[model samples]
Target: MSQRHVLQVFEQYQKARTSSCQTVAELANRPQNVETLQNAGVMSLLRPLLLDVVPTIQQTAALALGRLANFNDDLAEAVVKGDILPQLVYSLAEQNRFYKKAAAFVLRAVAKHSPHHAQAVVDCGALDTLVICLEDFDPGVKESAAWALGYIARHNAELSQAVVDAGAVPLLVLCIQEPEIALKRIAASTLSDISKHSSELAQTVVDAGSIAHLAQMILNPDEKLKRQVLSALSQIAKHSVDLAEMVVEAEIFPIVLTCLKDTDEYVKKNTATLIREIAKHTPELAQLIVNAGGIAAVIDCIGSCKGNIRLPGIMMLGYVAAHTENLAMAVIVSKGVPQLAICLADEPEHHIKAASAWALGQIGRHTPDHARAVALANVLPRLLSLYMDAESSEDLQVKAKKALKNILQKCTHLPALEPLLHDAPPNILKHVVGQFSKVLPHDSKARRLFVTSGGLKKIQEISAEPGSLLQEYINTINNCYPEEIVRYYSPGFSQTLLERVDQYQPVI
Candidate 1:
């Protein structure tokens, strides 16, 4: 019940060569007893018991210390300070399977507490020991070792490299495909953590033939395993287009599509994220995802409960829209314009707002009607707000400004158009004049409004150059303008004057 009582029991158990040591060790494994043992500085007492001649004493002692170390930073520091790592590392090769397993379990708990704890384990040469145990004959030892390696590699780049250099990757890949479903899951998770450290480490795993294994594993219907495998693939795909192409080559797209239909929220969310990364590199590649019905699934995620899910969904939709005119139209017809407007106006994340704004511009850039639709959503003000915000990132400002230019250029709304046209670029002027040409024929009010606003003079000036591309637009204006007005504005081309010139023509 008291710390001194547990310590005295531990001392008595250490001396006895009977099952009494096992009983005391099991008592120490109890939560209440472990707390007493830990608070009383029993690690020094337990350290020698880790290598006790009896397997149960060693197992129980290791298990008890591991339980205490998992509680908090101070306990873990105490476990490391008690110099338990070298004994744990040595125990991996022990003749008793339980000793190896218990040591690995304790080591995993210690290493997972913090990077410093993990580095301490590494400093004691746990990485190399663990890599050997990855190939152990006992499934329990192999699984424990693999799990421990994953925790070490979670945040330690050097340990990850050390693990990889010691040849952990291919073995882990082998473990993933084995019949033990639990081990396969742990190996898959470890591989994901390993790949997260760097592209070079990820590429090492990929180069060792993990992609095909991962692709097959993805179809296994294990929700947690699927999440980990997808995350690893995403990390790999993010580094280079060539590797992304490899993911496609493995026919991973269909599996990814299937994952989008998973019941698990994380699986669905991560699937959208991976597609977003793959779609970013090239339009051709993006089209593959769209062709696989990724657009509709991703559009649905725009309203996901989680912001992380929703943000990537909005971002993926934007990237997909940027790829093609038809895809952009697909987004518009899916009611994506209003959804994007919402993200721009109300989404708290500036990058999400920026992505939504850019997507709106892409959608509207295809035609005038699309631009008008986006502007009609009252998104113009929000876009202007983002573009002008001093606190907005440069990328956000740049996206907002481009979207504004696009919407304003194609917008038929007078208030939106007039300001833009007064300072329109040459190409934008062409689009504006083109819009006017379409409306002037059916509406006399439009014709008069155009002529009175110096639009006629602008057209005439455009027509002055014979070889200009605007010649056709100028010709349309000449055809559309009333005959009296044309003659008044351009007496040089009068029919009577042309007839007089024909009568005075020289003969050959």
Candidate 2:
């Protein structure tokens, strides 16, 4: 049969059946007529027939209207504001399980598209009613009700509050606790939607002990449920600080750490994000992360993984590095430098490499001893290689340049620079000089002289008198270089240089 002919016949059937069978066969077939009715503006023509048939043909009409809900908001609003809502609500009370299940499915679709219908669904006292249906002997009814409640909670804050008010937390918590992965998935998504809108509801879930349930699901063998649990925990962590703290307290670091190795990229990414959020509110949790060998795991994630996982894991490592110097040192001691260095070589991603560099910079910032350790690991040459390789690629070039600059600025001592000068790949050394010239401050003659005269190396020469070398270096730059040259080479470096110059001038 031709599609147009079929649609024509279905419309005719709908009109005729308006007075006869309440079956949805005509309505189900009407989905094909959606574009025709919309383009023809025949929605108003069908309105009368729709209202008349809604009661007797509630199932068919509701299903058809649910499908039509996607086409036009005007039609959806008309259906809801008309008599469709009360009929669907009454269907929820039907003794016929099939009708009840069908009505719940229709209502879920309606609520998903129309916020206006959410309160009506709620006011019909369907919150507690749906919670009961969650345990229906028919899995279809249970799934339908759970889905409808999720849509309701998503659109209506009051509906979410009402769900919580009706003690729906325990019910949803039970759903999450169930062994059935499908029900658990529905429960997780439902809780995510509800908690997203109402922090109070999120707290209620937490208070009702959803975290433990959620944390358990994080280990579920099913990858889908694990991903859902990761998402739910991320949302809940955002809403409840105490809950986030409790999650950390529950010693979930090991499980979260293990998720860093998940085959599903999103699962690992979100797990890292959740860990990052947990660390943000409770900085002390960083120690736990370190204790759980999170640093090595994160570095591995950054170096080995791609896309979403790499960026988030790098971010978490940066967070840990910034929060605690000891943890930062732990990363360095864990041989993080070589892993980060290798990532700098192969990682084409600008942000991930940049984050890795930023993490290295933070590690460098902890202490000179730590900076020297990183330098000795031959990290600078690899960073320089990345910078030179990317000099033509706009995005990576900029990040590589900035990362190299930060490394130089933070790790200024000779022990760090000597290996770059002496042992660095020749091409890499050129790149370092290129970056150094670009980043080193101009206008500071004293600073320019100090940097050029190998002040860093001289400082490491234990036999060299610090005062004498500094004075000679300052005098040489002031005499040899033009102000523009000085200004261009070491603009910001002079203050520290001049301060050292003044302190050393008298002592000499």
Candidate 3:
């Protein structure tokens, strides 16, 4: 139908009987009718009907306007520009229940689709009205009102603070505790959105006692609601050490950890991510996660999860190790080393390699035994492969080399370290030489392995060149290796032949 015909239909509905007006309201709510209503300027005609004397006509107009606003930013802007927010805001206080619900629905749709529309709603002082609607006797009105404020808070920081300033936090906390599942879910979502915008705002929500309610909400089987609550906790944890400690102090780490096995990928992913964030704060926090039996969940995620989850899972394991020796011991006991070894071996993406390799290094850093665990995983070969590759970026090579150094420091049992020196970058070869010199005297097997693998000779060859940095390593080997072995190997090669003739044969 042409725009003119749609306008005529809306006009007819305005004067029609109650049933007919409801029919028009239902029709206007159709997905196909939005363009007709918008193109025909039907929303403008419906604005006055928001205050109509007959409640049914008012419901029809507001509901139709809401339908038009859903997911359409320009139309939402048009609605706000139509000076309709105040009308909706006023109607929120109406004694007629349907009018209040419909007005909230319209406001929610408008706020949800556009940041500009959300700010417009906030500027019209809708938060206080929405806060009142939180106590509405109608559950539907309460849900939509909470949902609308959520949309507003989700837009940006200033408005999020505005929502908190207007006292939405405690109301949201109450909504989560309510029996109505839908209202609780929407309130949780609002709290989550607010927490993500800024640390101060997140603290405000937590200060209002939202964390406990949010934690309690996690026990519900509703995956969607659980996802939002976990995400909120994760975002809040990301703010600072104190907030992360707060999340753990609430004793919710176990609940968050259990979500690692959630059937939903998003929930699993967010849960894994939350573990990383929380464990990053301190040894106590890391120990809290480990004590709650979260390490097994992190291991499970790294071992089994698909997509991007595995990388963060690997990282979380490493982060835990770096925090404390006991936690590092826990990761080792959990067999995280082998899993991390597998991640490095799988030809995964560079980032995955970097995170895994860096984590292995962290695990090795905890203690000599932890280093032995990493070394026993046989990651040295993979790490060396990445480090020696000419094509790898500097950061990746650095991570690989650092992991190799850390692991090899505590374990002398490895394949030939000589191959690691071949064609290694200057810094990497220097490291290999230094490692050899450190071990050559104390470790007989490593001494035999180094000489047989030809690394010592290679160091000798490299050190003779002009301006070589390998000179210090040569000195170390000379000073530390068995004296007779060093004598037979080099035989005073830097001395003149004539001067050496007394102790060695002169060439003819």
Candidate 4:
């Protein structure tokens, strides 16, 4: 078949396939005919047909090529490597909304398949054309253009820089401010992608003072827009620490806190995750979280949230507890212990359980009083019970044992330590003994616990015949705690403990 003849056949097929009267079922059964045309180099020959088609045919051709984009790279390459790109660019200048959207879809496919094609599209002035589509009266066209620009910016840095140079930021910022939630979402996402490659663009976004507007969107009546804003903030926070600080300083915490109560699981989950990222970098912001009454909101989420939200919430609270002693105390005072304890009790997800255990340890570390508070909450007994339960996995058992050890260590001064020491279950005692023996000299409190509690007596009894227990305990103490703590009180105590351990090789 001649190239010209094949092109004619492809055009005929294209005309037949695009008719609104033609059923998709009819097109589906005609693969043989389609293959005959394709085998005759139809895609290669149809490049010119792309340029001459009316808006309807151009749209039809663009949609067909988008579908064929994944199936055959040759057709996609032909479309992009040929004058079809200029035609697509020209289509964007048209007033017809459908043609503009179709043109944007084709550009998206081209950008997805080939970075070179994306560059080519950009060189064809596609960026300026698409940016104008942001103002198009048709929302669908705006959405398609926003999506296409996002992909283009993600794949091509120069194109992204060009988009930023073309004043795309203000337009995108306007899109984010749009009353239409969907358009705002796509615009925010596109802005996020642009910001990743160009910090200048991120600064541009920040300069537009979009953070406050974004925070308002988080409280928007549309739940979908709230989610989009939260997600965008997460992305922005990842790139710019200044923007992150601004997010906190803007008092966006309350908005995010409210999102925790949203009925949509995705909204709550994303809000929790955003809160975690925000809290992790700016530990000082944990106080802001507390000030906004986020603790109760986050704690409330633990009961009904799925693992997605629950784990991050657990992790964030743990982060807060670790950073701020006062916040940790407040969490305990606000009854956060019971919620976390119950989550550990009822939620079987390992990561969730791990986070809970970690948060409990943080609480234990912050204040001995708070540690005793959790112990009094009865979480220790349940954690200890994990050791004996046949259903518990080894990982869960380890976490449970670790948390129990922290609880015990913290509560050593509390009266509850007496019962835990004497009436405590056997497995609990074994874990405590194992932990005590492993205590490093740097861990003064643990060393202190070993010395103050009956750990010293237990070591003495075990080492009575050989004295190896004393050496092992001494060696562990010298190695584990921080150098500063050891230096402050012990001086060369670390070396002395190791020397004593080395001198005697008695077996326990």
lDDT of 2 at 9: 99
Each model's lDDT comes to: 0.77, 0.65, 0.79, 0.69
Please provide, for model 3 over 164-190, each residue's C-alpha lDDT reduced to its tens digit, 9 standing for 90 to 100.
Answer: 889888888888888887887788888
Q: Summarize candidate 4's per-residue lDDT along 378-402 as a digit string, tens digits.
A: 7776776675566777777777777
Collision pairs in model 3:
none
Selected candidate, larger TM-score, 2 vs 4: 4
Tell me each candidate's TM-score.
Answer: 0.71, 0.65, 0.78, 0.68
Q: Encode model 1's per-residue lDDT on 74-174: one tens digit a residue.
A: 77899888888898887777647787887888888888889899889889988888888888888888899899989888976787887788789999999
- Stretch of 10 with least lDDT, candidate 3: 410-419
- Which parts of model 1 are misplaced by more than 4 Å? 1-39, 303-306, 323-327, 342-370, 382-508
Best-matching candidate per lDDT:
3
After TM-score superposition, the amount by which residue 345's alpha carbon in candidate 3 deviates from its true location, in angstroms, is: 4.5
In candidate 4, what residue range of length 10 has the lowest lDDT sum?
A: 20-29
C-alpha-based local distance difference test score of model 4? 0.69
